[model samples]
Target: MPQLDISPWPMVILSMIAALFYFIQLKLLNFTFYNTPLSKPMKTQKHKTTWELKWTKIYLPLSMSQ
Candidate 1:
């Protein structure tokens, strides 16, 4: 078998740090250039009937029995 040649530890560490920094820089640039704010808060519909409360009251004991 042939012997393997590996890079030094400092080079590996520096490469990982550089990659991390580049990813963070890319994310920051994308957020700055493309982000937009919502014009208005979303409106939610109000429930006319309390259907969940009625179902839970009827089914809670039935489920617990099993």
Candidate 2:
């Protein structure tokens, strides 16, 4: 049986940690760009349609009954 060489795993882990810190520093620390002035939303009036004004009973097919 041949043994696996794990020499490059340490460098790979270090690179991953460095990438995580880089991402956090660039994205998490730079959160002020998302801050903007808030504006009041426009009030919308609800209108009742013809179908909504009327109520109807719905029946399932007889074959669908348990």
Task: Provide the RMSD of all predictions against the true structure, rounded to 1 decimal.
Answer: 14.2, 14.4
lDDT of 2: 0.91
Task: State the TM-score for model 1.
Answer: 0.37
> TM-scores, in order shown?
0.37, 0.45
Cα misplacement distance, residue 12 of candidate 2 (Å)? 0.3
Taking the candidates one at a time, how many backbone clashes does each contain? 0, 0
**Model 2, range 4-47, lDDT digits (tens) per residue?**
99999999999999999999999978687676879989899999
Structure candidate 1, residue pairs in collision: none
Best by TM-score: 2
What tens digits encode model 1's per-residue C-alpha lDDT throughout 1-66? Answer: 987667587899999999999999989987856569768977998876877556553355655755
Task: Write out the backbone clash pairs for model 2.
Answer: none
Q: Candidate 2: misplaced stretches above 4 Å?
A: 33-66
